[model samples]
Target: MTSSLFYHVSGDGQPLVWLHGWGVNGSIFLPTVTQLSQYRSYCVDLPGFGDSQPQPGTIDDWAELLIAQLPANAIWLGWSLGGLVATRIAQRWPQKIRGLITIASSPCFMAQTTPPWPGIAATVLQQFTQQLEQDLQRTVERFMALQAMGSNSARDDIRHIKELVLSKPLPNATALAQGLEMLQQTDLRQELPHIALPWLRFWGKLDGLVPRRVSTLLPQTPQSQDIILPGASHAPFISHPEDFLHHLRDWLQTTNKGV
Candidate 1:
């Protein structure tokens, strides 16, 4: 179990766990995590990503493994597909998390015109899945570019993301495809209310992948707040680090006071 997953811990104070998005590893959070000196950050490389071993199982199976590896009773921060896992943990083991923060994540990640869900189109994800088989590096790089799409600093953002991604081991091909599938399949709308802990949602006004419109569509939960960055994209923390941290730190300070 010790080697099943990998987590890097830094900073010192309250514990804050960070989970990265699909196609990228936990190391993607380093830029943002390093600036936050208020809390101990446990950045975890989900199975098959970064330094972690690839494990085959549903998200439910993985959550049990995740909480066991990190400090219980810490605030959970997840981005993109990682947010789905964080929400699942909060739903099943509420006591393990004191607060929830999801960045550019949607409860349901597939577009639905009938229900009017705002998410990435199914066809786009399918293309990534198929492309991954042909060219792993190009597929991941494309996805990274998409995250920074529409941001004013998109060029810089994509370069930064690609640099971070290459610093660590590339994700397993299976894991990348599985992650896309998860994004297409997982839905946490009904379970949002169960996360009674303090929750904050971060969105980018220009994000193509988890559109800012999603903020309005999520089910309202008590003690929840949403903030959208005007010049940011899917990876706001990278595209607008200063702005992202401003809102993130301010919310953490206020939540610490109340929680």
Candidate 2:
């Protein structure tokens, strides 16, 4: 069962929901929404992030909880960990998602036991988990820096991320731990082919977290497409909103035209 999640709704048009990456909340997308003003946007603070209360469960559990509160049908856009949740929704309840967009995300976030996967090293994730117990704030800040590591405007990018994180209530300790566990254990590679929705994946060529190599390995559906922003890092939308929006608007327009 899922608890009521906190969200900010705005604009008026086709329903478009925004899901932020791990460690940050909905506010991080505030700067970019103006560019998407043509659509009715719902920026969500996933279960335990931002002001939402924490709920313990697996990725599917999080998806089920979120699906219950979403519009019957909407364009679902997710980033990083939120992307995993959004993909889960696309898989479990395809009827609810008109389209799926994933930013700086991978079907599998960690290396598999058999086939090699492009993702954050297991040791790096483990360090984050261990550090969280010692200094939650510092650990989160470190994660924020990692997201902007390869961007040309890395300092500004980190500032924006930190500002957004500080703008809301800090994520719950349990939620942080749970999110790390999800990143470390969740592997959706085999499940990717099962998703039938029109999917668009956006990546940062310089992203250290979700490497570009992962995109090559993702399951290719007939409607799947990907774009990588040069000189951008994990948070391409944050670092280069205009460039990100350009491609996004073009894709949406083209997709709409086809319909």
Candidate number achieving the greatest TM-score relative to the actual structure: 2
Question: Compared with the true structure, what per-residue lDDT tens digits does model 1 show for residues 1-259?
Answer: 3448898889999899999999899889998889987799999999899999887767776788798888988999999888888888888988778898999988888998886777788899888888999999988888888889999998998999989878999999888877887888888788776678888999999988888888887767668999999988899999889999999999899989886
Q: After superposition, how far is residue 68 of candidate 2 from its true place, in Å?
A: 0.4
RMSD of candidate 2 to true structure, Å = 1.2
Q: Model-by-model lDDT, in order? A: 0.87, 0.88
Q: Record all residue pairs in model 1 with backbone atoms less than 3 Å apart, i.e. clashing.
A: none
lDDT of 2 by residue, 11-81 (tens): 88878888888888999888888778888899999888998888788988888878888897788999999
The true-versus-predicted C-alpha distance at residue 172 of model 2, in Å, is: 0.4
Tell me the TM-score of model 1. Answer: 0.96
The 10-residue segment with the lowest total lDDT in model 2: 111-120
